[model samples]
Target chain A: MSVIILAVFAAVMILLLVGLTRALKSPSTGFARSFAVVAMVLLPSVWLLAMLVYADSEMKKVSFCTSCHEMKPYGESLHVDDDESLSASHYQNNRVDKTKACYVCHTEPGLLGYMDAKLRGLHDVRVHYFGKAPEELELVAPYDNAVCLKCHGEAKSFLEGGGHQYPDTLIDALKAGEMSCLDCHDLAHHLED
Target chain B: MVSPFQLFPTGPEATTRVLKRGVVAQILGILVLAGALFTKMPLLMVVIIPVGALLIALGILAWVWAVVWADAG
Candidate 1:
């Protein structure tokens, strides 16, 4: 079954290549242009299905998030966040597990969200290649604390005095500065240590 | 001589080429998933492999489809 699928896939690739050479001028209207038609319809669907499956199985693992060495600071900070270290309060206290609990905020929804992330990654890659990113690690800019608020919302008991305690009357404090969740807490998940 | 269809007297065009690649890629992606089920490899890596393949296919398809769709327009 697998072999047949692979062969059919290869055949389709060959057909598309041949089709491209033939239909350079007009593609859609052509009856032989079924390749374009099928591709157009199937790509997103496949991607969505794959993501759903992958996410269901492994995407939610905290270990996956802090795999990168750069994420160590983020990871360590999550453990260190407690009343003893209110000064270092980053991700809402012991309530949220730092290791496997970032996607709850960082991840957005839909195609544009995915594309935007990919583009950002491409930029990060380019920066790393060209030595433009930071010598050390840094926060994902525009890391609006708003995402933190998405879940925390100053509603959780543990967050009564949590670092991310959405400041009331900060109507000015928020606009006055570039404060974000990472400003205090270190990177949590996807650790490299 | 008459052909079954009046296919512009040549092989597929760029648009069709990309389309074919994408469909094949998606098909191969499915196969990868199946193979993963039968293999001992890490499910994470196995799953990820197909994602890359799928993206390549979709990216190419989008590129080509825009060309053909535009030309047709």
Candidate 2:
């Protein structure tokens, strides 16, 4: 499927090149002129649209996020069999989409969440390549409980789970920003001391 | 008996200029995409996607300018 999509793009590229060659002509008339217009403008526009769609789809993949050298360890942690690792347990238990586990925990709720993440990913790229990276990896901001609550806040199992204590009070604290889910669930990448 | 270049022979100087600009824009767009995806520098996509759209716009303008002006003489 991927190969076929690529082949289509390649064909389009070839057509675009042909269009460009035709466009170089000084004086075209009638049908030739019309073909030049379509080739030069319409075809390239379609190709660009397809490129954006392709990029968006690729961004959603776990492989895309973890391909970064700095992110490799964090990606590996997801596969750890230890029950103590929060992210690993989630992966092992199928609590999150394996393909989009990063997004599951990271994306805030709402339309802006995806856009925000994409922007953040851009920032990551800049920092990774052009900026002075930190000696140790850290979240750019403090972790937000809201990201967790987006999924588990209303889930029956989470609310009624034995592990939670006075769930309402904890949730209130979470909302008030007086508490952090990470305080108890601090195994994000499980970096060693 | 048709030569490739003659198939769509080079346009007037104005047409050539517009087409050349379009070609450059398209090349820049491709570079943006390569920098973004291949180097794991997705920040470049912020530039790439816009450049792609820009290429489309330029291509249209080039075509229109050619039709209205280049061929007028």
Candidate 3:
């Protein structure tokens, strides 16, 4: 009986081994296959989350608005300029978080907006790589009505500075075809001396 | 019982390898790139680690194909 039991135990272990191999084998496939499927499912989620967080800001907040690398220096200028300067309008406002990052204000909302921003970004990258951008990049923030409407479109009173000190003439002018917010609020934060 | 490992003769094999490893390697590469994006791993995509791995797998397949199906007849 002991001899038969030993044989049976060996047979069971062999059967388990064979079962695992058979399950793993897909003609030539292996256990490595499952890992790929899992990885593919995960990457886009992180990218999407990053986009959603940054999307809340206005479109002009894109780093390219004030300049590529120039914007950081401009943002740093705010701390030096202090709140007293007219340059400190929306940026250094007492209640608002002034240290918000570059993309927070520049990019748009949702996946399509991110794609749009990235497409524009490709152009900027090409320009930068080819040495087309000037040493001091232009402050061409496209403060269109759609951009301002992101924060103020719903409230008619907010557009008139009822509860908000933020500029709304931008939305009004954009609607009226007069001008845009970037015409004056041009720099990333504000320009230095 | 015949040894399963010896199912094929040890003589010269065919020289016409089909390059299926390229397909596997390509898929693994895309998954790795996706993983890098997911995990916030820096220099993963920039270094083209995914493509590099795929290339290595493809190279291995090419070598195997050469050994197995190398028109040496």
Candidate 4:
């Protein structure tokens, strides 16, 4: 898909070069003017929009998130051998798509959630470039239980777990955001010391 | 009643100048867009794409204005 978009962009740019050159040489010519409009204006508008969409999709991949030096440890954390590590467990066990592992856990589902994640991603890029990066990375906000419940809320192991069943209201508390899954399952990412 | 000439004074020099500006903008926009697309970096997403799009839009507007003026001439 990336290759295809790049190929189409190259073709459009070549056409634009030809049209713009002709239009510049003969600004009074009707055919050249029209060709310039189609090549320089219309084709590029469509292609730029396509590129934005492609960029958004690319940002959802783990590789995109982990491209920065600060994010390398988090990416490596996904491969930790420990089963207790939330990211590693989910990644190694195929709970989420490997290509989009970071996005799956970080982004809430739905349009607003997706937009919020993208905005945060932009902020991250800003901080990475212009501001100080912390020695240890932290979430901007507490990890929401809702993200976990989206998948685990109905899972057999989660529902049948002794800790959830013992208090009876534990599940409801979790659902209502009164309890955090991390309280018990705290080894979210065991980064190497 | 405003004549089209009053609204968009047409001369070969004016057409050439405006068209040159438009072409320059389009070329710059294309370069920026190409850089963003090829790099696929998050920084480029924030910085490059918007700048490229703006340049392209300005170019399109200039080209249209030049075309209209040229036709009137």
**Candidate maximizing TM-score:** 4
TM-score of the first chain alone, every candidate: 0.43, 0.78, 0.48, 0.83
Ranking by DockQ: 4, 2, 1, 3
lDDT of 2 by residue, A60-112 (tens): 66787887777788888888777878888888899888888888888777888
The CAPRI quality class of candidate 3 comes to incorrect
Q: Rank the candidates by TM-score, best first.
A: 4, 2, 3, 1
- The pairs that clash in candidate 3 are A61-A105, A61-A106, A62-A106, B14-B68, B14-B69, B15-B69, B15-B70, B15-B71, B16-B69
Q: Which consecutive 10 residues in model 3 chain A have the weakest lDDT in total?
A: A35-44
Fnat per candidate, as a fraction, reads 0.06, 0.41, 0.00, 0.46
TM-score of chain B of each: 0.43, 0.50, 0.36, 0.77
True contacts kept of 1: 0.06
Model 3, span A1-193: residue lDDT tens: 3354335334433433343233223313334233222222222233223323323232234232444453556665556555543335545553234444344345565687667766665566566556466777653555444544565566667555543344545555655648654455444445565
Kindly list the per-residue Cα lDDT of model 4 for residues A40-104, writing each as its tens digit.
78887887788778766777889998999898988999988999899999999999999999998
- Taking all chains together, each candidate's TM-score versus the true structure is 0.44, 0.72, 0.46, 0.80
Counted clashes in each candidate structure: 25, 8, 9, 0
Complex DockQ per candidate:
0.12, 0.29, 0.06, 0.52
lDDT by residue for model 1 (B1-73), tens: 8653344322335444555465455555544544433333233443455575565456555545555443443
Please give the lDDT score for candidate 3. Answer: 0.42
Docking quality class, candidate 4 = medium
DockQ value of candidate 4: 0.52
Task: Write candidate 3's Cα lDDT for B1-73 as tens digits.
Answer: 9864355333222221223343344344434433332322122322344354454355345434433333221
